[model samples]
Target: MLKEAVKKQLHEGTVIPAHPLALTSEKKLDEAGQRALTRYYIDAGVGGIAVGVHTTQFEIRNPEFNLYEKVLKLAIEEMEKGNTPDSFIKIAGICGPVEQALAEAEFSKSIGYDLGLLSMGGLNHLTEDELIDRTEQVAAVIPVFGFYLQPAVGGRIFTFDFWKRFADIPNVQAIKIAPFDRYHSFDVVRAVCHSKRNDEIALYTGNDDNIVNDLLTTYHIRSGDEKIEKKIVGGLLGHWSVWTKKVVEMFANIKDVQGEAQIPSNLLTLGQEITDANAAFFDSSNSFKGSIAGINEVLRRQGLLQGNWCLLEKEKLSPGQAEEIDRVYRSYPHLHDDEFVKANLTKWFDERQ
Candidate 1:
């Protein structure tokens, strides 16, 4: 069970970046670079970090690589070293089949992780009932942060019924809705709002394409005879992995106007600017083939990463992706955290040494 204070922190909302992997040119984990990235996130003032998710590359689970435990250990160590608050969330990504997922959940809990960001990718072979059973088994070991990944990625779609039942689980504390489809996104929200445990489950947006709007709009969902209100309290996003300081500041500004009768026109415009930047960073043009590498490119430019390397050799930036990143960099100087990283990159690295 989550401590009341930790649960309160999640309900109040905060930014939690989907942590990325730092690799050397030899395709080996750069221990120093990995530690530096963790320190960078803490210093950026983010409320939490979600490691081993899609942004961290699923290939890390391969026996050839076997970086799952090492990556999680590295992040928690840095979090401890930084003296983060108890409310600073630690999420370990849990994936694979029922047996593998259960083992990952148990390992994550043993290492002081607070929640397991459960992924349902590569499990289409299982029925929705079977999937729910799998989730229940994992939840028995640790609290769950349900993930609805977009099909454009490796994610498969789940029915609204699946979400309703999933939310009914007592150990499920939150959900990251990122199907990237407005209708499907609504399905998850409506299901959760209709569930008996709605109040206990925090809704976090994984929809990187619509981050600003998701946070600003409140949903008045109709479930049978009653109307229920729900809001996406925060984001656990891959887009946030880059320009984190700016993202943190953006989230704060959004929160300030969340309760206002009329949102400022400037904030709406800023949303498009952010989506435009996401298009470049996430490679929305080429079906996101370069998405992960695109994030690495930004960090590489900021000097946080030695290079943009993925476990899979074919996962490099797609054609014209670099130009798109450059265009956004030129167009939206306000959105980049280059200056923040510049002033602190040396210090972050120095701490690791």
Candidate 2:
């Protein structure tokens, strides 16, 4: 059964921060550290958590460790411990072959997860019709969140027609638009808006580079004589894993003035500032070599992590990436919720202990 709290949060607009893996010096999943990360998001007041997503590293699904099930369990356990009212939504990343995706979706439902974030990773090179069939198979098991992961990170760009059909699926709850290309991003919006189930499928911005602007955008969709307006209600982003208290506050600020005729001038300026921060944190300016590492660095600075360590040594931040991260830290002090992190870091760690 869908939890009332999760359903309410989705419709009311809220941030759904992506979960990042915390690794030990031995490059193993640090149970304490992972729990700390989950509690941090809860303390920061994120309405939901997306575990096992790209930010958490897809390698976790490999047979050597098979960290997928463990990661999901850890997140839910920590979420339950931290969430006073149990309002936090849990979205497990469900991908791989059709059977694997179906299995994960069933497992997620068994664990009380509200939704499954479906990626087209294993279905690559398949015809669109075949892809749609795979999606429907998983949707039968649980409500699925369609993903538009950027091609920069091994994501396929589904045709607009494909998206239109995908949205029409009854159990597809939302779409995370992260194409990063303005044109392709709109294709998702257009597809959903034109779908008969438009009202049923919500839109979330996974475009880390244009988060603020995406939230501020307004799309008017015309199907027949009826005109329906669409807006990116919130986000499910890896960028949100760090400085999350501030991210939640930023979402609140945007929600306050959504659809207003007189938008605060500062809100416009924030878009550029956030993009600059994302460029550095995402390492987009440097071929994204520091993608996951960049996020871990921020947490390290906040004392939420031991260091910028990953399971794979090759995933370490690129040359000069540290300097770029340091530059953004100094330049965009407003963006980091350092104060909040400092105050809660010790407590978060203490909880795990």
Candidate 3:
């Protein structure tokens, strides 16, 4: 039923889309670049996209909202483009302020997005009532896909009660779960997915580090383990899924039952590799800023991303670090060549016998 639901969404413009690893302007989308980005996903067989329209000082006090306006116009243009299947999957994204997000949400609906969500970044901890009120405001406008990420990555995380409140909104179809504490991913996925009042609300993982494991494991069990082994969450949205085409392909292939018997090895290998990579780039290994920079570089080298576009990552790459990234990932080769991507992808899903 869950697989069918996901497939239905995929067929209905439900692309398990990727998000920005970094919001910095080191590289970014221009008119040509945005179209190129849309094409990149279509080529990769991805269904849709979620562009981040960022804003600063959203503390609800300084009072300058609508900061993400230009970004929204760009993303909305892509969303609005009337096109074919290879052209249109789905477009999910975030706008800065609640009011602006509401307008953007309505626009996304008007433009035919499968799902629309608001970024919880710079969001102050609203009271349960306030959260519900705001959520209903958006839910009434569009299919409210909740961006329920913890604020570990320079954003604010909400409380369980806050989620319970938000989920109560009728159109709250899903939540993007990227918790600061890894275990919170498990916890929130459980709490949100199993809510009697929120059964319709799905949990999608945004933590790239946990993508394979997240998509492969079961998290429905609260206290015990009947072992819901078929996986619950839909997919990664942030760093993991952005340029990791091979990983997504591996995932798409893994969804096939005939491929299930062979999934464990590749799943483990891929999960571990991604986890280690993210850790080195995101967690203890370096600053979150550096990780996004590294990921963008990886995407550029792989040719899935445009070199002209860059996020304004707070961390700067060292003199040789950029070259070193190319040199290091060359051994893997999947990062660059499509033939190599296909080869590794085949090994992961087909040759595992």
Candidate achieving the largest TM-score:
1
Model 2 agreement with the true structure over 148-214: per-residue lDDT tens digits: 9887777887898999999998788888999888999999998888899988877899999899889
Candidate 2 residue runs with Cα over 4 Å from true position? 84-86, 351-353
lDDT (0 to 1) per candidate: 0.93, 0.86, 0.52
Q: Is candidate 1 or 3 superior in lDDT?
A: 1
Mark the regions of model 3 whose C-alpha exceeds 4 Å error after superposition. 1-7, 10-15, 19-29, 53-89, 197-199, 222-230, 240-244, 257-263, 280-284, 302-315, 318-324, 335-353
Local accuracy of candidate 3 as per-residue lDDT tens digits, 1-353? 12344435542222365544223243333444444444454445555566542211122122342323444454455444424454343545644557877876776666556566666665575555766687777777777667655555555656665666666668676776766467666656555644554447666666656766766665436524333322444653655444445655666655553225445576577667666555543433443544445655655554444551333324445445565565535544443335543443322222121
Residue 139 error for model 1, in Å?
0.6
- Compared with the true structure, what per-residue lDDT tens digits does model 1 show for residues 147-168? 9999988898889999999999
Model 1 alpha-carbon drift over 4 Å, by segment: 351-353
Give the candidate number with the greatest lDDT: 1
Model 3 local distance difference test score: 0.52
What is the descending TM-score order? 1, 2, 3
In order of appearance, the predictions have TM-scores of: 0.99, 0.96, 0.73
